[model samples]
Target: LQEYGLVSYHSLNLLKTQALALGLPPADLRSIKARYSFAWNDQGIKYLGITLPGKFEDIVSTNHKKVFAETKSLLLRWRLVRLSWLGRAAAVKMTILPKLLYVFRMLPVPVPKPLLNVVHRDISSYIWNGKRPRIPFKVLSAPLEDEGLKFPQILAYHKAAAIASLSESLLIHQPLWTYIQSIALPGHSFPGLLFTPSKSRPPLPTALQITRWSQNVMTNTYSPGPMPHNTVGGS
Candidate 1:
């Protein structure tokens, strides 16, 4: 109450409405306070300083834009002075990759392919002194011993990151998976969802995108004995 100097009248009204939506009476002090929250702006609302959005996919896409912007800034630094081919490769692998890894590890949502291409362009321009790449990207991205530089294809990292999220609960089979199962997946099991092929409509963008990516990672990495742990359905 305003008399107690705890909260403003406007905050109290917002809390009251939110509490009512949860089927709690506004008069209940516990419910009122618990429902209390503040928005940073009209476009964003932060709870405890965390910006959770209406759609799950927005979180990933928004963060990726930020990563891209920061990477772009870094890339501009080298626009005037191009690094050696080896030096540029190292920067891409080391400096740029980690910026991506931070968000990729945190959220496994689909990243737009074009955004990755933008990063690739920056790296390529820096490497060749603003000239186009002479070698095919596939050849240039090969391992060091294969008479080519070892540049990590960002998409592969995206797929692996997505696979890591889907395989998280499957690998452990923890109680937390109960929450995942409850989320709009009705009759589908996560194992069948990932391992079993389906033509049915995808449940969520995260689910669909991650499944497609997992398939790609599995197909690309399939070999004798190397896939001992990740194998499913004998393939």
Candidate 2:
């Protein structure tokens, strides 16, 4: 078949020989290749905006820095314009929050506490025009009906996004990602495995770590008592 393919093999020489036998030109084959190496300095190549085979923490940290930088630039520019408190809040919701929410949804990882604090501080400064705040952040985060500004709570929103991702994986039957994630979770049903305690569960792959962490967080937050183990059998 004359189709694009990805080959993973132990021996590069063996792979090259097979490719030649299959009529794949050396130049065409060499043009696209990624080999894991202990001495490699570069991060994995980007495919569809994700850094393949890179550490999940590194990806999250990179995106976090980007989002913070972009938001800070926007806030500085907006400060030049005269806007009411309400208008500032609207600007943040429309522009800044969407960028953050996108990252939260895409990665679904537990954001570092220090990173979250930094974002919260910068966003607070922007909202208050770098002056002492007249209203508390918690009140600002409340809905309009409750006499508040409906400000985005970064930590809450991040947790919600992680929970949403977990829900999507659980509710969707045999999702493509589940198959890949399941490779690390042999013989365990995804739904039941979610209920298994962190100590009892095996070390999860990077992609599923946030989902598992979010599950535990939700259980702790909402459950009246300790959650029972409910691990189901079969892969």
Q: Pick the candidate with the highest TM-score.
A: 2
Candidate 1 at residue 139, lDDT? 87
lDDT of 1 by residue, 1-235 (tens): 4554465444454433221122335477455455555221323344432344545557755577877788878877866665677777787788888878777776666677888888778767777767877778888888879977777887778777866766665665555744655464676665555544233424544445555565556545544345546444333
Backbone collisions counted per model: 0, 0
Q: What is the lDDT of residue 106 in candidate 2?
A: 74
Worst 10 residues of 2 by lDDT: 14-23
TM-score for candidate 1, residues paired by index: 0.63
Residues 24-141, candidate 2, lDDT per residue (tens digit)? 3767545533432123323544434544334555776577677777888889899998988778888888989988888787777767788888888888888789999999998998
Instruction: Return the TM-score for candidate 2, rounded to 2 decimals.
Output: 0.70
lDDT, candidate 2, residue 198?
A: 51
What would the TM-scores of all predictions be?
A: 0.63, 0.70
lDDT of the structure predicted as candidate 2: 0.68
